[model samples]
Target: MKKKVWLSIKGKQQTQDQEAEIIELLTEGELYNKDKSQYILYKESEVSGMEGTTTTVKIEGDQVTIIRLGTTNSHLVFKKGKKKYNRYETPYGDLLMSISTKNVDVEYNEEKDPIAIHLDYNMEIDGAHGSRNTLDIQVKH
Candidate 1:
């Protein structure tokens, strides 16, 4: 069964020569579980610069993957102590992005649903030093 859920996201990005940039968002989405994996489906907001895109977050064990489609397309995977790369396509152009994951923390509710997830990773864009980023997300029923 699919459940309606609310998502609260807090993101921080720190890059060399720049102070930390923080982004916070609150949105509603659908959450479901299948094959022992949890999935969240949500629409991208204009504030995120991808108004027409749909975003899906998949969580399985210690790995997390985010896939975005529509106005922009990208697939990113985060696994602790591992690195993954992908291409991000936007209206402007396509950019190469990589994520070197530092940590993945997930907290679950008594019902076996995820209540919170935190990710710490270093991101590189276009082969340039990008930023150290952290994403803290809280899922609410």
Candidate 2:
């Protein structure tokens, strides 16, 4: 079932102590597939620098993968205690970024319905410390 949902994303960069947050109501967002892996699909906003982009969030057990397509493109993998690296493409060029996941917590209902996803990680861009970040995704059904 496709439902109108609100997505609230909070991001914090440790060194700078600057916190950024955005809340978007997505009439096109859908949360489905209880028997297998779950997925969240939504479009990106213009303020985020990816106006025509679509974001796909895939959750399977303890792993989470986020893929972006359209104006900007990147594939991000988050797994507890694991480090993953990928190239992020921008209009300027492609830059390599690494993510070291410290924690991944998924909340689900009794019937295995996904409620939210929270993760904390350290990020590096081109082998330089980027930020210590936390991302919380709330699914409002």
Write one digit per residue (lDDT tens) for candidate 1, span 60-106.
99999999999999999999999999999999999999999999999
Model 1 Cα shift for residue 84 (angstroms): 0.6
Could you give candidate 2's per-residue lDDT for residues 66-122 as a string of tens digits?
899987899999999999999998878998999999999999878676678898999
Cand. 1 TM to true fold: 0.96
Q: Which ten residues in a row have the lowest lDDT in candidate 1?
A: 41-50
User: Which pairs clash in the backbone of model 2?
Assistant: none
Which candidate number would show the highest lDDT if scored against the true structure? 1
Relative to the true structure, how large is the alpha-carbon lDDT of every model?
Answer: 0.93, 0.80
